[model samples]
Target: MTADDFRLILFTLGVSAAAIVLSLPFGLALGWLLARKQWPGKAFVETLVMLPLVVPPVVTGLVLLKLFGKKGPFGALLERSGIEIIFTWKAVVLALAIMAFPLLLRCIRTAFEEVPRHLEEAASTLGKTPWQVFSRVSVPLARRGIAAGLVLGFARALGEFGATMMVAGLIPGVTETIPLAIYRSFHAGDDDRVWMLAGVSAVIAFIALWIAGRLTKGRHPF
Candidate 1:
């Protein structure tokens, strides 16, 4: 691999990791809420959460662009604060996180739901507070699922392309990730480089799935 290829690989890995880290807390909270709570508009909220999964990547990217572009409300506010997101690595991270969020949440919510309710009730009866029960009993039981969700999220982030391209603009050594670099190489007729990058992506994805499988082994009922 060339120096540029190495750089792109690192950038992609960094962005994917950042996206997962940033989304982790929010995914956990939403997953738990969806698993355990019943409320008005719950279905509506779920549909909204799952929207990105179904939407075209370009469409998602466009929406993000409108919301985070320089003239957009959020973008303007951030600009006033001296933080720019559009056409930057931050945009790439945001795009990946948004795209991967629903998958992560679904896995985590399923995990939470699979936890035995009686265990939580038993803990409650034993004078354990809700928070204590959740922290000690529920989370531990669902940890495997959470790990699966995280791996899935990371893999999704690593492969992100359309939305990231729209927001981050494929800036070399800045926002160019493995997928983007591969796309550039293919279009530029760099067939060898394209194959190499594709191979790298495949290997990374396989490693992530292998780790996830190990984490979830014997835990899932299936």
Candidate 2:
């Protein structure tokens, strides 16, 4: 209702969108690989990918903070380039991407696994390269499921709180998101603001789930 509330909503939406865009390429590649191949370390890789979902969000955030803090190797390198992530808006995106990755990957992998290998083979027989078969036949058939995965991922990003708090401190107009705003509002005894923000988040999440369900046609990813 207030300008600040609207700003938080917009900020959260922007960060969630950025998180989805950042993670999608990696998700697509890993999903296709996991669905189509069985390498020696596949199990290990799968477990690693799912670790964030099972672990405490704070733990994930701590690890990320350590890795991206000023003294950390990556952070130091970035600092030299005049870039910063720790306790900044970028950290919010980082947290959301990491937290949402597993769900996105699961949906995408399942969709890719369901794609008929015979169809790919048929394309190959027609002199289509692997990329062509993937980009054309395989992707087209799996489009609906991929879209579902994206919606789920976006929803997950929107709800992220713990890990985000760890890496991106609640700095209004900078790093604060919907969940963070709710936390601050509740603690400050601003019941009205909290209720409004909660309603907005619930409505957004419901719409996302509805769209995902329709896209997947009530598939497992929902």
Candidate 3:
């Protein structure tokens, strides 16, 4: 309703979108590899991928902070390059993307697993290269699940709070997202603003889930 509220909504949307875009390619590649390939340390790799899901959000944020803080290795490298990540919107994107990754990877992996191998083999016999078969056949067959994963990732990113707060620090009109705004409004005793932001968050989450459900309908049991 207010300019600040509008800004918060926009920031949340931007961060969520950035998170999805950042994670999708990696999720798809890793999911496909996990689904279709067998290799050493596969279980270890999977457990590592799912670590963020099991760890406390604050812990995840702290790890990120230590890795990207000014004195840390990556942070120092970036600083030397004149790139700052700490306490920025980029940090918000990183936090959300990390938190949303496991969900997206799991969904996409399941979708890839559900694609019949025989279809790929048939395409291969018809002179289709592996890449061609995957692009034309496997991907299309698994599109519903991929779309669902994308929607779920976006919803998760939109609602992310703990890690984002730890990294971005709730700077209004800079890195403040919907959840951060709600926290600020509630703490500031702005009950009307809190309720408004909460309602908007809930509505956005509901719409995302509904779209995911529709996209995955009759496609996979997941």
TM per candidate comes to 0.95, 0.96, 0.95
In model 2, which regions exceed 4 Å deviation? 218-222
- Considering lDDT, where higher is better, how would the candidates rank from best to worst? 2, 1, 3
Q: Decide which is better by lDDT, 1 or 3.
A: 1
Quality of model 3 by C-alpha lDDT: 0.91
* 1 or 2, greater by TM-score: 2
- Among the numbered candidates, top lDDT falls to 2
RMSD, candidate 2, Å: 2.2
| lDDT (Cα, 0-100) at 188 in candidate 2 | 99
lDDT of 3 at 1: 100
Mark the 10 consecutive residues where model 3 has the least summed lDDT. Answer: 213-222
Task: For model 1, give the RMSD to the true fold.
Answer: 1.6
Clashing pairs in 2: none
Error of 1 at 55 (Å): 1.3
Residue 185, candidate 1: C-alpha displacement in angstroms: 0.7
lDDT for each residue of candidate 1 in 1-222, tens digit (9 for 90 to 100) = 888788788888998989999999998888898999998999998999899998888889999999999999999999999999999989999999999999899989989999999999999999999999989998999999999999999999999899999999988888899988889989999999999999999999999999988877788552
